[model samples]
Target: MMGGLSIQKQRRLIVFAFITVPLLLLLTFAYYPALELIRLSFTDWNGISAEKNFIGWANFKEVFSNPEIFGVFKNNVAYFVVGIVQNIAAIYFAVVLNGKLRGKNLFRLLLFLPYILNGVAVAYLFGYVYDTTNGSLNYMLGQLGFDKLSETSWLGNTSIVNYSLASIGFWRFMGFNMVIYLAALQSIPNDLYEAASIDGANGWQKFIYITLPNIYKIIELNLFLTVTGALEVFDLPFVLTRGGPAGASETFVLKIVETAFQFNNYGLASAMSVVLLLFVIIILSVQRYLLRGKGE
Candidate 1:
């Protein structure tokens, strides 16, 4: 069919074919499933049932009316707050590592190592660290003479359990965020900093004017990712606490899983999923608008 086509046209056709095939596959596998999930949210199906009765807004109504749902959302908000702290810490470390420091590469490697570990493994590892009696943390507190903290149950205490889980998230992800910020820092032109220094700009002033401006977009991107990940956090919390100790650490995504698999309320779970998705979309849209306004 391409026998009469020019050579450049033939090359373009080949490239288009390569792109089109994967695009089709992505639509078929990824988008199709997502659309089906949305459709399922409006029905009454136990996932194992042969009949899926259309229930209009009933599932959404149930989700909105449930009081427990608010608590799950509050936990998600706490996760997002902790994620903000993680990004701040990551940026600080990235700035320090980008400086004239020794063993920077080694430090970066050590920090990033946790991010590559399996989530389940990390969860179990932290589970031991948070054990009430035998955990390393309490043991260290004992050695430090803070005997009172040594007996405290890290994961069992309702007041601080969510913070404890959020700390694990920080530890696991701070390094990854640091690496991203480091890359962004390196991309910033050195000449800009030199120019600022020549004008007698102090370290803090230079950071505010040059560093922050240059990496603002990267920071926005990271915030978007952090917020989405925060809202959808599941694996670590699931494995570590099973959303237990009086459901103090249950995340929104974990609640969805519990409702669907444990409670066999597949339709309700789907409705929750859709609500979460819409919430994410709205938040991201606001973030985009703010970033655009700042850029302008």
Candidate 2:
């Protein structure tokens, strides 16, 4: 029995080692760099310099004092709000596509196709679309009765650039969300709808009571994903506006990258990154707490 126990312990150790090695590697490679960045946020160290000096709270104060940072923060919030709208729109579109319709597969493919393109490529494409002179938008507007319309620089305006970039997010992810909702919709039993109809419940009533409640878990999951995705928005804005003409469209991730790579202020960027991580955790926790359900 003692020899058998020893053999069991040895096997367990081997299994644990197998599982732990990759995770430890990930932490070593990924987490240490992140932690180092966070620690650096307390200091003033240029990326190229070997000399590191600690300046506590100063970097944070500078970050907060800069209106551009907060302006970018506002842009992030706006993107979050727009993302909710986009998710709702995606669900609606998904519901439509899930219905028995011709070219439904084609519609799904078309909608999701934009997600496959490189964000930088998409930015350049839209740049041409919104170009002030001889652009497609201006040409369309001119051809329309709005001949007096000014040729608007869609990517250049601080006020509209965030939304313009967000529109790309909407177009790219809407199809993905639609597919998720479509899968959820398909999972819902048809008998519930039939019963609702038998009870003289109208379409709206069925949708509100049956369809929504059934898909609430999916909604919760998707909302969590969208919230995180919105918070971490970088590529689209970076490529489209590079935080823009006046630092208007900068997101939290973009700010972090700019601080670390561009400004070589690694410490401040890490601090901001930690804050962003905390923000995401809080948002997700609140959402999960609020959306807790029997099914989930």
Candidate 3:
């Protein structure tokens, strides 16, 4: 069909066709559903209902006024704070593993193993680990002579339940961040470090001046991802605690699920989902702007 066309025009046509098909599919599948979700947020529709009543802003008003909603966001904030600690731990592991150490590849593989497991499997595994009676953690504590802590309810107590859940996120994802940072670390030029060493710069000084500056972009990217993951966390908390004992571990996404599936409040759930999406967009936009400004 393109026999009469110039070679350049044929290549351009091929490229356009390749791009247009995926772009069209993306708009059809992804963006269309997203637009529908926004539309649903403005109406009162039980998921089963054929008729949806247009109730402008009512769902939003209810979501904002609910006391439980505030607690859900509070849990999200707690998760985000814990994620910062997780990022720091990942950086430490990455820095150490990037060195000329024996068995580093094996160690990296082991650390990253948990992240590749199914979320449901990880949840069940950790559930057993955190179980109050006859759990591995309690048994270990007993063996270590901390018998008092052996009987402590790790997932049942409100005071520590959020922390317990957050720890799972740390364990599962820290290796992912470590691998990213490790890649960044390996890409740093050895000449920079060599030059620093000749100038009598110590390990800490070299890290501060040469290593940190070179990998700052990757660091920012990891931090942004951590924040977003923390905000959207649902699976582990849902499978392990069901956002309980008494909603102690309730996250925003879990709340959205419960609202839509359990209570049949599709409109309210949609509203909450839109709000969460907007919150993430605004946060990421601010982060991108700040990073770009710093780069400039």
lDDT agreement of model 3 with the native: 0.89
Cα lDDT tens digits for candidate 1, 1-296: 99999999999999999999999999999999889989999998998989999999999998898879746888776678899999999999999999999999999999999999998888899999999888999999999999999999988887788888888989999999999999999998999999988999999998898888888988999999999998999987799889878888899899999999998888889999999999899989999987795622
Number of the predicted model whose lDDT against the real structure is largest: 1
Against the reference, the lDDT scores of all candidates come to 0.90, 0.81, 0.89
TM-scores for every candidate against the unseen true structure: 0.95, 0.86, 0.95
Tens digits of per-residue lDDT for model 2 on 63-99?
7787765446778776777789988998888778877
Q: Candidate 3 on 60-140: residue-level lDDT in tens?
A: 998889989745888777788889999899888988998889999999999999789888888899899999997999999
Clashes of 1: 0
lDDT of 2 at 233: 92
Candidate number with the higher lDDT (2 or 3): 3
lDDT of 1 at 293: 55
